[model samples]
Target: MKTLQSTTFKAIADDTRLRVVNLFVTSREPLCVCEIVDALRLPQYQVSKHLTILKNAGLIIVEKDGTWGYHYLNENNPLNKMLFTFLKKYLVGEVFDDDIKRLEMRLLLREEGRCVVGFVDEKDLLIKIKEKKQELLVKE
Candidate 1:
């Protein structure tokens, strides 16, 4: 399990990966791959690659309902024990800002047992909003 712990830590070592983890932790909802990519303002391939690493390290799990794959925190994952302990001891003053919270709530509202393209569902309107966030982040 040391290998797993090491791998998870390495995967989360990058700012992007750390942000992704924080997003997942604060959202408290199963998130689609596209949602993660959009929220993080990352290229689709980059997001997918990092997600694969996290999954391999046993830090996250993916659930596929049709073509949409939703990723969520793995409570039973051994890495989570370490992550939670670390957060409890060190991340006390952290908060999910308004933008992140808004993104999370929008994603939550889009869930309907399966993933659908944003244009296909009225509830998926949040996709446009997420895109705006990407634009803003890129400018920074």
Candidate 2:
């Protein structure tokens, strides 16, 4: 049985890992690693590293669909339930809020009825960001 005695605490001990947990908790939807990178504005490798730690710690679960993998909170674990409850009630800081906001924006990039634009490189993201900005400017 997975226990919170070590891995769970270690997983969330890092600020970035904790933020990633909060992202999953708040969204209540499995998120892809690319979406996480875009939302946190962190490098892909860094986010993937955090994700691996979380997965190893049993704090998150991965679901694979073809080439895409989505990460979700391991809600079935009792320890995770307690931790998520605490986080949902108390972790209302600006950084988490900002992640959620960016996550919402990232969702907007989806091609309607599909998961996000699906794992674009940094260059692609930059181009998309510029296009989005232009669209906003035209609308305003």
Q: What is the TM-score of each predicted model, taking all chains together?
A: 0.68, 0.79
lDDT of 1 by residue, 1-140 (tens): 46766776787887666767776776666777777765665677888888888888777899987877889888896658668556434533334354365455456435244444432233455675577577768989
lDDT of each: 0.66, 0.81
Tens digit of per-residue lDDT, candidate 2, span 47-79? 999999999988889998676678988888787
Q: Candidate 1 — what's its lDDT?
A: 0.66
Number of clashing residue pairs, candidate 1: 0
TM-score of 1: 0.68
Worst 10 residues of 2 by lDDT: 111-120
Candidate 1 ranges with C-alpha deviation above 4 Å:
88-99, 108-115, 118-140
